[model samples]
Target: MNKLFAFFLAMLLPVVLFAQTPKMGEFTQNEIDLKEISYEPGASAVFLVASGESRFFSNILETNYFYRIKILTEAGKEYADIPIGYFAGSTNVEVVSAIKAQITTYTNGVPEVTTLGKESIFQVDLGNGYKEFRISFPNAQVGSILEFSFKKADKNIEFLDGWSFQRSVPVLFSNYQITMIPQLEYKMIGQGENFYHRSEKSEGNGVYSWTLRDLYSLKGEPYMKNYQDYVDKVEFQLSRYQTAATTSGPEWTDHLNTWEKLGDELIEYYSVRGFYRTNPLEREVLSLDLSKGSQKDKAEIAYYYIRDNFINEGEDLIYTKQTLPQLLKSKKGAPGELMLAYMGILKSQGIECNPVLIGSKGHGRSDIVPFPFLNQFDEILLLVKLDGNLQFLDLSDPLAPFGYVDLDKHVKGGLFLEKNASKLIPIDIRHNSNKLVFSNIKLDTETGDLVIENTIRNYFYEGLASAHLVEILEKNDKPLEELFSEKYDALEIRNVKVDDLLEDKNMYNISFESVLKNAMSEDLIIFNPLQISKFATNPFTQEFRVFPVDFEYAFNETYTANLVIPEGYELDDYPTNESITIPGSPIGFSYSTENLGEIFKITARLEVKNPLIPSSSYGDLKFFMESVSSKLTAPVILKRISIP
Candidate 1:
């Protein structure tokens, strides 16, 4: 190996290096061998390479201790149950103890990693400029029998292989559910990119094609209000990636020092001598009291002003120097500028309006503390106080009518105030307007794995939300198909109940239950994970995930899921049904499970109680959320049915 390889390989060989691989576990490939990464469309490819098949095993180790490839096969290519290791290593699959964290990367948002287990590490000689290595995981805990499928498409591997790669496990996970099977990510592009991705399943199409977190174990326990304490713990561990200070944010002690020392450099904008006055249009909005003008007349007047006075522009132009005056003079503009100009006209006519600021999904979060991280604000909305109620207007998000926000723009925390102000305080508001409720479940089984299904309907938020997810899973929540093969062999899903049908608020409700056959025949089940997540079983789940959850008004929703047990199984225990009220708003959970019909009956009531939870109540609000989440994972055991 060269000096560069010798240097990095040596540096990264201690954590889980195991001799030939890098211990740091860089989540993605450090270098790309153009020749190795290639693909062909509509061509046949055997992605399920047989075990002990090639020299790739050793080369993979040399690169980092991790090597995984995703082949884009022609669509409709059929394959069999890939022979992944029954367990990860040389021995009978390591079982529960085998799949724990050995090493990890990441300390914050964007990505995270959780190593379930590691199998045999075999180093091999890759012919040509390539080398390889192989490591397997029994992966007995993955969704739906651990089927890592390769999508067959009419694309070529000639860097048909050319695709994005992340640093997480090699599995397919979409926006909501992880897609182990090839559900199709990129299809015929160009004409179809926009049209095809319109489905909810496709929202996370490309998102779930790979792993969620990188190999570096870089992700942290989900966000909690005690983010500082969590960050301290993460920084203490993980020798590879280290956590840094948050500058002037709440977590830091001497935030000002850290701010000036580590924050982004500010650019000075000095006024030039050529500054000119704004040439604004003389337009006025007359919101003739509904009592004053006919509904048709009011709508006609609004439509005319929108059509004749505003110059339509694209998303990019909306953020440029297209000031209100510029758009007003042209009597035309994009969403932001147009809204500003529109509000200006309305204000001129004394209609009264304000600009609402929100942080888009990927723009980080909007917690308006003293320090200003303008980058966090990625979206804007027009708010008008009419009859003491604020009307949400997102001219940028075209389909959001005039009273509601686009799904992506509807976040939990943001600032809304009269436009001409620098200081910001909390403002009371409502958004999305959909309510949500779910049930608690306890599955008593003879084995560790089984198929699970839950159906959902969209009523309030679902009807008003403009998201591909709400659209596809709109009529029905995605079909449930999670059954770990190694853990359990057979399973079934039944009673997919859904109601409250609608076309506009497209309201629907679904009720379903899961039946699992456990692998262990012991009189007692060790641990049953009703929901799968890294901390799905952790007791401190509540303390770790405290970010305000935005159900965004789903309309007083309610859900009841019941689990039917086998004849021999009986409920040994259940979480006591209890409800805790959060002050300032209606939000909490109520649940109970009892032995009924040779099966366990559990009804977990997850109610938003109300649409909006004030930030002042954030403390109790977070605690309540965690309490319910924790209750959801409360376990129950199945005793062997035997009598003298």
Candidate 2:
């Protein structure tokens, strides 16, 4: 009860209460000042151990919002000491000071980490004279807690509204989670601002925290402006690691000199480390008979091979180019490696195969720049020259029919990656050489409703549906559901069957039937949507998108829709029965409706006689689509029958 003791106890009480608010704490005794210093080269398992690690798993995404990343090793060395590469280009925006380190570790072990919880794994502002932040970690285990936010204060630039963060280096995680806190006070400026994780009070200066706990909704990242910038910056900054001189120039003058030197060094290093080998079998194991098989046939075979053996490595490295032989026989490979292997194998078989760079569905284009970032193209696939047309083959997609690459990876804007050279040029792979046959709809004048049936068969349709059927379903069901709703209000889809005729051929048969509530209604409620089958808005319409229109395989389609209308309603008008075909364009749209006693039978078809619409002729292709879309909307008018 003495005054001296009482004072000490009062001070202790405030200390306990202040710490209870969950202010972030330092895991290490020392911290690096961010303003004074920006990066750490390598990372220590011990350092991250103190910070914690995450091993979270997800079937849908390869990365997460938990944007915390660190380097684990240096060129062939156990990085016990954390180096600068471990923290290069890493910046953080502060979030809510927690009463406790909110951490979630996916697993535990010395080198194994998948957790994402704890304040130790994050960078925090360590009070100094100037603006500065610091973070330190020990040899971490999996499932470490992490929190990060984007801030204009931290970086010179303000937050971009549509900006999204992606992995600088591609990685396959067991799971991914990210907690992003928005500073509404600093409103992001741009289109799609409505998107970015915002709080309930969307239009204010509020600090709200959100986390990508599962990353279930994110599309696999394509190329990003900042992500590419980061990569370019990193590549440039780390020129000491790669051949920097190769950064510019049409072709490196004796460039392989550095590549060759590196190759020789790698050969020697691998020899010492027991990782080097020359496999004759690798060069010869897989062979493509491209010269002989029809493009469709080649597509079919590749589709089946990839679908069945798609080793779900997720974003993990399956087989590097150096390990092609092992991957060929193992029947497991990276998306790119597998694609190249198929090309090589086909080449061995006398197939005219080429490696084509794909920009994917999300972003990037095939535009050229002197110091262009290779990340512009995140996907690689094979293209075969058959007879004269070019075929886009995603050998990584087994479910994709011979003719189609899924829409995500189906961006047709690609350049070729050739050996000992980088001669970039546009590749035009399209939907042509195929046709569709339609059977029309008939209405019964007795009832106010009508029944219809249509069958869709693709001679060759390949893309997103075939390959990412699972991924699409796993990622977002709303888009698919919405697409169906938009197509038909009273539609019933059935017998959705996809087929592969042989190891090298593919086909699909879909029978859909629908009944409209007011086919005979006075208002033009009936929207006869000759449905186009793709998850994405065939964004390839003629006017907006200038890229070549890509159709999987040229195929013929036949649709039969027989409709029975109500007694009071009958087919009053039919689309001016007409059909048109354009020269050099593979697609044709045609439809006609007829009236008989109490029945209206209608038939229509849109066929692609070939794939690979050339860019030089993109305008014609767009016009063809605009015309088809226009004609498809022109419907047979259903007039109400007057009572006698």
Candidate 3:
């Protein structure tokens, strides 16, 4: 009798453990009765349970995912329509079988479940070798609990997807489990692991698991580069694998186990190293007259020659899809190919340069983990050593200056791909005067209108961006006044003129006139001194920030306004001269006003010598920005004198 009872208890133990794990089409009373998460009081939705498991079956890697969410508000209903995306162009991974989803609601303590039909699942082709399978829960409402599950199969173990514990909504419980086989070795990289509630490893069965509870949602801040970089997540990379060679056993092979090994692999790749050896544009490069300028000047000439001749296909890819010959013949190629061709030309002219791999801003932080993961990078830029100075150039944009790198690609550092010396190097971002505005303001005595003449100068990256905008407007046959009108909505812009557009200079000038109607009343005239204020509003409005603020580059914005008082009006009130600075930082703002009998001169200078502000300094930075905004938008009041 004792033996029989023990056998029955063992059989029931497996069922109890399986029931503890969240399953599809099942909900507890507590989950159904939940109205809102206590920790996240303002959250629209909450993830009740999010779990995933991955294991190898018959040498094939398969992963299963399950998510249960509780909708607490009208906005939470948007989560009912879930879209799962996968790379359909590759033979590596695929969505297995159909997705299962259900919506559960309770009425008067009685539960009702509505299942999603197979025919309701929609497939959307998201171009560029990607597709999404979308599923919507039936009868979803504010109090509905939406649950969905799906499975994926991967033929190649190298493409293992990482797990994110946090999402845009609060998560109550999250778990991830993985079972590893003895034939392969994987290195685990984790971020925010300190937040984990349970981390267990069963070495006997090669099973690893991590769990987190009551995690707040991740929200974007003003100057955050990418929220994904700060999320709590874990990823696995295949470090070593076993291959069948002999009848005795499988042989172990190292795969990207170190940064040096990864560097060597990238050098041997056909699209990178082969392109340099071939030098398809050698003939075209020799025809140019590069003999007149210095080495730096000659490098700039070659940069423009390639930029103007070859059209960019507008794709940000690290590896080129076509050979150098194919690209040169077609006269157009991806940005990587064009940059490589530019490198070849520079090398022929005895210029020193190397290709640098960077993960763009949208691609997340390049150096988040210590592991040298190749997938982390997506863009390549040319780093040239000229005149004893290093210059980073993004040849993708024709309007970009010789030493200009796009703000999105301005990473802290990147992998400098030099032959046998490939390693990470610090990127010294060059600083240039970004914007300067000078405005002359006067009141039209007869019409009671404010007349303003403004001259705006943009330099470096700012100049390149403005040039691109002007080119686009010209291509569309739009008036330049539209730019100012959109910016200064309270004024009417006219006689707009742009200078130095598409020229060799790294700056452009814009001059325009504006008229503000009814700016003056019978007794008083009120006007804002700065017509082209840099800060329309304080950008740091959030109470707290989780990520550092990246302003991309250091810049100086100087605004000078000369106001000529009306004939019979006298200054009653004006903005006071003030200065503010953040302690221990190179950020400061100053506003000064000079009251000369008839002319009022106002000058405001905002200097941000350090572009990146750490999250710890967000409060001081926010206050500083708020002060600047208040000073720039302060009103200057004038009164009309009555002769007794």
Candidate 4:
């Protein structure tokens, strides 16, 4: 009987060890109960244990990372699904271990477990550059606890995205550990919360760890920067390396310590493969009646030559290996290559133009640290100095206006890569943007019906965004008429005319007509004079504010309406003219009504004078918007005149 028992114990030991949870604690049936985590209010799911560790192999020069997550949440099951992306080259990363996931549930005081099969996993090929591994938890349900683990091996040290402790969901216990060899030196940078509960340093073993508990979920806010920028996370930047007695690596400070050094490095990096050295196609381009134009005119000519001739590939990179001659011959190149060629052309013509690097809006701000970090910048433009003024140009977009960049690319500051030295420059959008809306309302004296005709014009950056919205609507097979009807159900719309779809213009115009309902009564006629007000409700609805408001750019929206009074009706009451401005903020709104005997005039203007609003001004901003919304939805009451 003793010998038989020993044999069974040996077989089951391996199974029991493999099923153990992460270092936070051992998994139990009690963890599957939803009531265990009911204290977390407004959380979709609660992470029971979130732990990960990375191991670096010095002999093989590779890093292996393993992570495990145990979660319990029937309400927010979306967190149970995971996606891991890997590059598709020979020198890229790959998943070396199989994923293990299972769901545990308790019923009638009995615990039941269901393991996921290989069929639940899927791989997607992302076209030459990358691929994705996706897995879905099996039997995922409320009151079910899920546990999953996976491992990834990567040879490229640059692919280390680091670890994030705070996520969109609340975490009960979070921990991270990393063990590295003596050859690699890393600069550690952290964001969000500063304090950690546990910090352990290895004893001559090159291991580091951090632990935190009961982290709150990151709330979603409107008009804020990228989500990744606000998460509590730790990242590593490989600053140097050593082998035996030799040391060699990137001198982060020497290369990017100052604005001048950063600019010089950028110019040198982009000028590789003799790009922008000499433009063989410059003579041919200049010969087309553009050789004799002024400096500004010639610059425009060169820009169109590149914009119309080359097809823009939307890859975001600082440098390209494709030579200028090859790009010219093929008439196809990435955005970087095309912009490089444009710079080369401008240089060939003796025009003064420098490359300006900026961070895209969705990519977050570029002001993280003064260190030389190339990953912060994702787009490049040209800063042309003509007649003692700077003109910004973006040739990557074929449909972009002549002297303006994309709305998202109009960042506040950028690094200017000058030939001799580099410097930081500020960009403003108020110089090239404007929005105007006009409405003409005619009231039928006999029928008490309102016919509204509206004309809207958007220029420059505002125009680009408006055009994109129209394009998306058309692409999704959604008509503007249908959308307008859905938004204003009390109106019947017709004669929707939009112009400048095929032409290249600095601005776009949209005109439409709508007949409003509930404007007629036996003794009273009531209607809203501002028919084209865009903001029907305030978007800043959160009770507590933490993040700064980033509008991306300063903008002005103006509405002017001309309402004709019916012969038998007289104005009983109207919205009072009022103007309000925050004490020190750049936000302001004004509404005015004029009682012309036959025609009533109404004007409303909302102006965001600055692109950024600090959190200190949140209360005033919210109150101002609330007042604007209330006034916009108020009705203008009119009473029938008795026979005199």
What CA root-mean-square deviation does each model show from the true structure? 21.4, 18.8, 7.0, 8.7
lDDT of each: 0.37, 0.39, 0.75, 0.66
lDDT of 3 by residue, 1-644 (tens): 13432333233222111113467766777887899888767689999998988776544566778999999999998998888988766553465655788888878877788888976688888887788899978777888888888888765566477578888889988888877766667888776533343444344467777788887787777877576665677778877665443688766666654666666667667345445553324565245777677878888787777778778887878887776667667778878788887776676666777788888777744354566778878888888888777788777676676766777787777777866677887776766857999999998767878888999899877777778888899999999887877657877889988887434667788899888888666577776767466574788887766667877778988999999987778889998999999977669999999988789999999888887777778899989999988888888887888521
The TM-score values for the models, in the order shown, are 0.35, 0.43, 0.85, 0.78
Clashes of each: 82, 122, 0, 0
Task: Return whichever of 1 and 3 wins on TM-score.
Answer: 3
Compose the digit string of candidate 4's lDDT tens values, residues 1-644.
13332333233222111112263224644454445444455566777777777765422222333343444445677866878777756545454466676767666756687777888778888877688877787666665566667766665553255677766666767766666544456666655533232333243356666767777666657888554555666666655444223256422211114667767777777677545564435554334345676888777777777777678876855677686667767788887778877777777666777888887666644344445566767888788876567788777666665676766676667778877778777876455466788989887645656788888888767677667777778889987776367546778887876775323666878888877654665577666756456665787876555557877777788988887877767888888999988877598889998878899899998898886787678888888888988888777877878632
Worst 10 residues of 4 by lDDT: 12-21
Ranking by TM-score: 3, 4, 2, 1
Error of 1 at 245 (Å): 40
lDDT of 2 by residue, 501-537 (tens): 4234444433455556545555433546455433112
lDDT of 4: 0.66
C-alpha lDDT of residue 467 in model 1? 40
Best by TM-score: 3
Q: Candidate 2 vs. truth: CA RMSD?
A: 18.8
Provide the lowest-lDDT 10-residue window in model 2. 232-241
- Of 1 and 4, the candidate ahead on TM-score is 4
